[model samples]
Target: MKKIVSSLLIVSAFLLTACGSGNTNSSSASSATNSSTEKTSASSDANSGASEQEYTDPSQLKDSYDVIIVGAGGAGMAAAIQAKEAGANPVIFEKMPIAGGNTLKSSGGMNASETKFQKEQGIEDSNDTFFEDTLKGGQETNDRDLLRYFVDHSADAIDWLDNMGITLNNISYSGGASVKRIHRPADGSAVGGYLVDGLIRNVHEREIPLFVNADVTKINETDDKISGVTVSINGEEKEINAKAVVVTTGGFGSNEEMITKYRPDLKGYVSTTSEGSTGDGIKMIEALGGQTVAMDQIQVHPTVVQKDGMLISETVRGEGAILVNQQGKRFFNELETRDKVSAAETELPEHYAYLIFDDALAKRAKQVDFYKEQGVVEEGATIEELAKKIDVPEETLKATLDTWNKAVADKKDEEFGRETAMDYDLTEGPFYAIQIAPGIHHTMGGVKINTETQVINKEDKTIPGLYAAGEVTGGLHGNNRIGGNAVADIIIFGRQAGNQSAGFVKQ
Candidate 1:
């Protein structure tokens, strides 16, 4: 991690010297020195496996452009692609060496309404129903207008990706909805990465420039209006002017400082989001006089692999799996909303739970196979063996299993109201157990944006030449975020922000 951090610092220094307008001689010398240091550090880190350096400084901006998209994640890429398609010269600035932010690490599923897949499956769904489901799932804290816009436009966004040569498997999975609306990409990675790939291809084809390894530290303003950005690269400082700037730098899921301060409950907990999700966009936008919504609300995924912080999608339970407590007792309903399930599980003595399954279910379930392939699953031929492998109590597990078997035989999952008589009992000696904990997944709050995807000030006024999308701009997810809604939010709002930005530039 140190090596990675040092590499990032060196990359930042190089970018600063390459882009900034600092003192010419000093800047050149600093750039060379930083380049040498970066190479040495990167090599050393590679050999020693130290911590990666974090590039926290903002890179100097170019003199001018029609659009500047920060963070290269799903939201940022979508916004940049839309802006360029609308005849605007847009550039994407990424702090990491790689373009895909948290999007790449996602399960590649998107939530949309009234898609062709839903029509084929005979699952009756509509934008209105989608809106109602989102509202209910979020406990009514979400911005109704934004939710409506997201549902109304999400299908089109899917179609737009299809037009751009990105393929969806035409399957709708179940989520927090009356009907199945989650769409998955062919590769089965999160739809965010696929979105990033499509947008990146388009960006390259159009010759849109992307500045990787460049971090934006601050948003520069002049007289209460947007101006440009300030960044440090290669140990030198530089500034760039821009006509419009968009903050798509994602959320602060990985920032311990922010998480501890704003969401103390999640502090020291594991997160599956990328390392770059340190709330850079939130900090930058807030510093620019933007007001954030639902800052205290962070989504906690119910089924993440507790050992190495791997995300085990809730879809596993949707298929057929049981969550058991330390006492070896099945707890909540398997199919309940994440918030309810997480809340229930957290109340347990250890604040830990294990997902128990048989070999047959493991093979059939998407999540189990995914993790197994990733080498994160532990398997055993007996409950005792499984418990020993996972370091749980053998007697406790056996007792729990015995109680559960009785419940199954009686056709009553009384403790958690789970549906009775799930086929394929745990009698199979070769059983499996995966430790799970509530991990930070998403932040339902960020910079406030209107329906047009325009960044709004504390007074609810639009910030001219400034826009935000994705996790950076909140109000889409209220107190809770529905599964697949995050993908919908990024694509739908990203496109809107792009169109709005281009329209503004034209005027």
Candidate 2:
């Protein structure tokens, strides 16, 4: 939910990199890039109307509608589309200058199971395995009903996107997935821009009256029932009446004050979230007596450019990259869940590690090319040369590569118990390294919700006429979020919120 910027400029900025401005020219750990690198920015302009379309002015907004969707990210847009399809009048309000929020920064693909894409690829998968992995990944603290509903409906979400002309047939691995469930664009480009672009196109086609720079300050209620919302646009406040309101205003990972309030231990950690992700919807819902869960359970992604505040997607590790400490030694499984991998990094001598890969991986994963273009990637024609570039000891780096290649050949990992993503070794040159440390990524806690996407109050009763989806509402992720699940959460539940709210309106 960025503010005060032009719509076209903001969208262009998201295309430049993940988040934030400025570049790092230093060769040391000072410079950085992320997996969320928008290499498709050029194509995005040509393909999506997000940059070219005119946003509805505040004067044009209706005094009343069947559904008022807050935040024009993926979730809010999805809700609006579904509401229109369900025979309801829905309008979207985005506080930011642009529509896509942190959803645009996502690099890892959407997670789903038992999809036709997976079946065609001969990859055996099931919702049971997905549910088990997610429960384990969340440390088994997730709401069982919510998790069950999520996994069962994820494949439908994939197909839903497909129906909108967004094909995510490029399947790959994400940490904590039993099989290759992370689905990306068919060309294997990053998924964030692709999904956001597609959703924006659909919203445009439906004439959903999506308004940017329109912030919903308060969710109004009358007689303990949803009545309307108070919105501020261009320094003018207006009360818009609505039968239902959907809060999809994302999480507060980017808000330092809130992050410190909930988790004082993470006071100085850099964040990879969008500036608009200040938990606005959470605060509004909480003021309405809504309940919250796991507020302090903020997640710091393992691979982040500490200086630039950019997130390196876990797809790198999931695609066979390795993590090595300053001493050029492997410590833990690189493909472990973000929390565990980040925890292991904290135990290192310098509390940071380098994601090591070779030309083989760089050729396959397009994000590497973006990293190099940003000057964050250090390259060498040989292992020893790369070690010198990144300041790692040459012999130790060489020995580490040798041992890893052997393990790859033997098809067994005895050191740290890594069993997947061993498709290739580090023999191919030139080698690459990016100095990374943990950065605040996802806020696993927010306003609590039920499987129906209804906002639950402190009394554990559903808040009438109030529904939320995406990072704004929590309990689906529990204590930790698995990669690719966030996209699934927003789309699946956004549609559910729209349908359920529309149904409630009809009743």
List the candidates' TM-scores in order. Answer: 0.81, 0.92
Lowest summed-lDDT stretch of 10 residues in model 2? 25-34
Best by TM-score: 2
Note the clash tally of each candidate.
37, 1
lDDT of 1 by residue, 295-375 (tens): 888888887665555667655554446788777667777656679888988999898888887776655454455566556
Using lDDT as the measure, the top candidate is 2
Candidate 2 ranges beyond 4 A from true positions: 1-14, 21-53
| Candidate 2 lDDT tens digits, 1-507 | 122222322233335655552121111111112122122131111111224334554556679999999998889988999998999989898776567777877787899999999999999999999999999999999988989999999999999999999899999888988789999888666787788878988876777777666777899988878998988764468899998999999988877778889999988787788767888888899899999998998988999988777777787888899999999999999988989999999999799999999998887776676677667789899999999998989999999999999998988888988888887887889999999999888888999999889999999999888999999987888888999999999999999998988888888
